[model samples]
Target: MIAPTLHTERLTLRPLALSDFEPLAEFYASDRSQYVGGPKAADQAWRTLACEIGHWTLRGYGRFGVDETSTGKFVGMVGPWFPDAWPEPELGWDLMNGFEGRGFATEAGLATREYAYKTLGWKTAISLVADGNTGSAKVAERMGATWESKLNHHIFGDVNIYRHLNSEAV
Candidate 1:
């Protein structure tokens, strides 16, 4: 599947690549990843990135690797995803270490949400932010989402699902 490229004022979202592995591995190895099922070994991180790419091939839509347009630095992954056990398609985002505090996640997330609604023809979208992840919760809120419910998955534990109130707002 050909992944479409998306852009914001400061970032560009594109297909995942081999170059994304190192930083992704670093993120997964750190405690910051706990909310997103991280603290993984290098190999696990590799497989995880691979799975992200394959998600596009199989599902025709998946997370995009985002980079800072000005510096061309990788920031993180953000886009639409619906993994095996997920209840439904969702808009998700994960930022690299130094990228947090910059609102990059929210920017990319809003773009993905718009893509899911306008480009993918989705009527509604939700962001499955992990419980206790205040940072992500803030991003969701900034994107105009409101917590609507919670979900408990065998792997992800408890996560709060924030529903997008206006799909056309984007």
Candidate 2:
């Protein structure tokens, strides 16, 4: 099924398109990159978005382009991803610098988690965060996920695992 657009008080989350690369490129080039594995060059960003698009076709769901509802500006992305050789589904997100600390990630994440469990019937979901990425870890915890274990992510490199089980309360 095609993933539908989701909205929150201040943001709109929808599937991304190749045309979004321009605005999203700024986030890829910002200092926030350290938390999200650092800035990717424009070319690499293009490659990443292409792969993300492919994930949508193969996995039935993929990242959504986050935009501010008030201004209709692209802010970031959030959704499901499967890392190389990983055996489970993963929840992931990245917000632009200007949009940080506003609870956008937490809000969007909660909605996605609900869709994953209640709508999609997923029993569990996982997130891989960089060891030093306290922001993301906090968001995961707010979504009712607990620390699982530290694992070397072949794609993102070193990371910590956080998981949410559908059987539990959020």
Candidate 3:
């Protein structure tokens, strides 16, 4: 199923669209993408975006392209992610430059986690933060996630996994 649009207090989380390519590609090309494996070429960025979109078809749940509600400006991507070989379904996010330090990632992440449990019937989820990605760690902490363990990811080596409580069960 296509990802349905989600609204938050200050953001709109919608399905990733073709129009998001330019900015997202630029984001991928920048050093700011270090935590998410960036500084790549435009072609690589395109493939990454394609993979995010393709994930929905494969798993019925995937990332949402987040935008500022009032301005309709793309802010970032946030949502459920569970690739093959992943230790668990994860709630992941990437906030573009100039948008960090705000609460966008936390707000969007909370919304996505709610959807993960309520809509997808997930009992638990993890946030995979690359070691030393303190920004993401802070967001996860703000979202009520607790550091669970560490694992060496195939793609992102030496990752910190934070576990979130199932809101429904709380």
- Predictions in order: lDDT: 0.90, 0.80, 0.92
Error of 3 at 136 (Å): 0.2
What TM-score do all the candidates reach, one by one? 0.96, 0.90, 0.97
Better of 1 and 2 by lDDT: 1
Kindly indicate the candidate among 2 and 3 with the higher TM-score.
3
Give one digit per residue, the lDDT tens place, for model 1 in 92-170: 9989878998999988988888888888888788888898999999998998889999899789899999988666565
Top-scoring candidate (lDDT): 3
- Ordered by lDDT, highest first, the candidates read 3, 1, 2
Ranking by TM-score: 3, 1, 2
Candidate 2 residues 1-170, lDDT tens each? 45689888887888888777886677787778776756888787777778777787788887788888998887888877775687588888888778878888888887787777776677789988898899999999888889999998666678989988664564
lDDT of 3 by residue, 97-165 (tens): 789998999999999998998888899999999998999999999988999999998887899999998
Candidate 1, residue 55: lDDT: 97
Model 1: CA > 4 A from native: 168-170
